[model samples]
Target: MGLAAKMDAPRIDRGLDDIYVKETSICLVDGDRGRLVYRGFDIRDLAQHSNFEETVFILVHGRLPTREEYDMLRKGLAESRAITPDLVRLLRRMPPDAPPMDVLRTAVSYMSNFDPERDDPTRTANMRKAQRLVAKFPTIVAAHHRIREGKRPLAPNPRLGIAEDFLRMVTGKRPDPLSARIMDVALILHADHSMNASAFAAIVAASTLADLYSAIVAAIATLKGPLHGGANEAALRTMLLVGKPENAERYVLDTLANRGKIFGFGHRVYRTYDPRALILREYARQLSEKRGQEDLFRIAEILQEVTVRELKAKQIYPNVDFYSGLVYHLLGLPMDLFTPIFAVSRVSGWTAHVIEYWDDNRLVRPLDYYVGPRDAVYVPLDQRS
Candidate 1:
């Protein structure tokens, strides 16, 4: 007999799918309408008009920053972009073969020791630390990449904007206007999604009243999972493995035949196509054309077509991960750095959620319904023998 039949109770576990844990003003994810909103502003508007820094400001604060506030936030981020020498040395000493996400997780944890307000959970202190993490994560990711490649990490350029500076740090050259804008929009699109795994992890840790760094570390660790942030990396590699546009159909057929996942073709929440994917697909196409690498985009498109044709009946459509890999590649980033870039963008949203959760914080403890071997007596090793 099943547990439900024997115990007279139905199994209610669903991984908390479709469960609304709490209300949030930071973002609105309308999966049905294929829309995303941040602080009451449509993502489409923000992507077209706002930069990453400005979007982040809106997320952390409840409103768009005025020119004065914008300048202050920009200046603060620029000033905080330099990681400590000790942090650089520590990144250098870490196992050169460690996954970039693991390095990032460790770096955030290590940073806690250096925080003067590590024990202080005051709103001001948390906000200050959030600014620091937001500014420094990109630096940490770039430093780790350079260290693994036996190159000295570049210092952040205080004069450049966040997207431009991050591109420079990663590639040692200032990006052109189109590339910089693409990166900026990419960052804005990724800044937040309601109750995602990483944000949930951050919120759970913060609810325990842990330090901000610890909470972000929890977020990063959760993002490292393949099912979450790593999907884009997998999607890119899958496209590369297919090798040509002509091979995409075969690849999809074989994967489907074997019951393997097509990583970028579906999302848990979105009923239609993801709005971010819709935005990024255009950028991916334009960027690949600009870079004279249109063949890669062609293959991605063919695969997208096949995936949709095969699965549209089930509402399995492309998510942001589908085209974002191509965009990052066109931006001259290695696949391994993709999730770290995700972290760099998403730290803004993570910090915002953590800060907001503190207003009426509660521990996120859920009880499991036990139905296995209840009321059994304990057996000692000798008795068992």
Candidate 2:
């Protein structure tokens, strides 16, 4: 092709919105019908019946684990849950006020130096790395939370599952059965969404044949963007500002009148309600009642009612972010830790995608149509403009 023809080539899919880069069987997101299926299991069923460890196993392995397989997976995760002492010292050295997500991104990159299989690219090694990542993410987030709070990090309890251990480490108290179960379900819900920004970012990095940790670093950085993973924190702040159920209508009306986004009410892919949000809405209600924060839940309910009434024609509805923040708050998590908690769950999905993509790896280079001047005359060093 000539330069002129190339330069004038029509652009296609500006944001890759209509593109299909690869085939995936990890998760299916049916936006029009409001369904989410992970490895052919409906999200509602998984949330109701499966634990986080089991859910993660299904995502990575593509089938329900046998009882012996489940035991091994659990044991692997538990054994890998503790961070090295050097990592603890690094966390202590980090700026106390750094955003937890930033800290997490850096910490994940640092961990690559110590991975036993860092030099190996075999499928078995990658699977082991994936398991280690899923296990340590909670520990990393919780340890950073404690260090920033001027408290010493707690050692992992080998007997506890990921959700229970994270809660125990972060709060220095053994989680109640209900709170632990809620945390487990929350993890399962956030474990993956098909072709979301961060997961795509992970696969893109992996396409370069990068190591698992490096690809996860890319994912974490991408997820830190407000348009992607930070919505839950922003949404929760808006709810707190509303402060009472009575204020919700005024808040929503004014925000809508000013054409400001009411965070957590819409999604890029879902034209109907987000199924994850539907599951979490009930949990938010239950936890709020238990924690004596029913007014906050009431505020959310009012916001949802008004927003749906006004915007249902546009197909706008509550998304996963809407109730997730409330659930985290009622579980005693701080606001800044919200997005990090998202990473804690999503690392499972990220690694799964990375490993799967590597099975038939290809470079993900896309072309940008050049629009600059074609034949600019070169000027001598002393030539006038």
Candidate 3:
């Protein structure tokens, strides 16, 4: 018998499906309609008309920012982009082959020690911490990449936006205008999705009145899991394994026949096409053309075509991870760094959710029905079976 049946309890939501924990105006994810809205603006509109800095303001403050507010936020992010010398030394001492996500998680936790407001939990202090996280996430990721390659980390250029500065630091040169714009749009697209696994993990930590850095450390660890933030990296590796466009069909059929997963093709929340995937698909195509990666794009196209043909009846569709890997690869990032880049974009949402949860915070304690045993009498160790 099932645990609930044996315990004579009501059926539990195994994954907490369709459960509402609290009200939030930060984002609306309409699975049925394939719409994603941040605050009050549609994601598509934001992707086209706004940059990551503007989008961060919306997610954090709950509305569009005035000119002065936008300028101040941009300035703060620019000022916060540089990691300290201690952090650089930490990065250098870490194992070169260590996973990027683990490095990110540890580095963030370490940097918490140096935050002037690390012990301060006021909304004002948390907001400053959020800004520092948003600004420094890229720097940490880029610096780790450089250190792993035995190179010195580059300093942030104050004149550049977050996206441009990240590309420049990682690559040791300025990015072309198109590439920089694409990176900015990518960051904007990924800024937030309401209460995703990583975001929820962050909320759970924050619910206990943990410091902002502690809560974010929880999020980074959660996002490191394969089913969460690692999908893009897995998806890209699958593409590379397929090796050519013509092999896409056979690979899809073989994987389906064995009941194996196609990493990027499905999502837990989205029933129809993922709006972010739809947005990135176009950018992927454009970047492919510009970077002479047409073959890679064609392979992705064929995989999507075959997967959709076989799985459309089951409501399985391409989600954001599908094209995001291709975009990151075409933009010159390595496969392993894909998820760290994801963290770089998603820290905005994670912090926003944590701050929102603290507005009317409660300890998130839930009960689990016990089914293992009924009041068994304890025995001394010598008499135990």
TM-score of each: 0.95, 0.96, 0.96
For model 2, residues 1-385, the per-residue Cα lDDT tens digits are: 5776877788677778988888999999998999999999998999998999999999999999999999999999999999999999999999889999999999999999988798699989999999999999999999999998999999999899999999999999999999999999999999999888899899898998888898999999999999899889888999999998999999999999999889899887899999999999999999999998999999999999999888889999999999999899999999888999999999999988988899989999988776677898889979966
Question: Please, what are the lDDT tens digits per residue for candidate 1 over residues 1-385?
Answer: 4756667765685777857877889999898999899999999999998999999899999799999999999999999999999999999999989999999999989999988988888898888898999999899999899899888999999898888889988888889999999999999999999898899999889888988888899999999988899889889999889898889899998998899989788888899989999999999999989999888999999889998999888999999998898899999999999999999999999999999999889999877766676568999989995
Clashing residue pairs in all predictions, respectively, total: 0, 0, 0
Worst 10 residues of 2 by lDDT: 1-10
Worst 10 residues of 3 by lDDT: 1-10
lDDT of 3 by residue, 1-385 (tens): 5765767786788878778888999999898899999998999999999999999999999999999999999999999999999999999989989999999999999999989899898988999999999999999999999999988899999899999999999999999998898899889988888888889889899999989999999999998888888888788888999999999999999999999988798777789999999999999999999988899999999999999999989899998998898899998999889889999999999999999999999999977866676768999999988
* TM-score: the better of candidates 1 and 2: 2
TM-score of 1: 0.95
After TM-score superposition, what is the CA distance of residue 346 in candidate 3 from its true location, in Å?
0.8
* Candidate 3 ranges with C-alpha deviation above 4 Å: 1-7, 374-385
Query: How does each model score on lDDT?
Result: 0.91, 0.93, 0.92
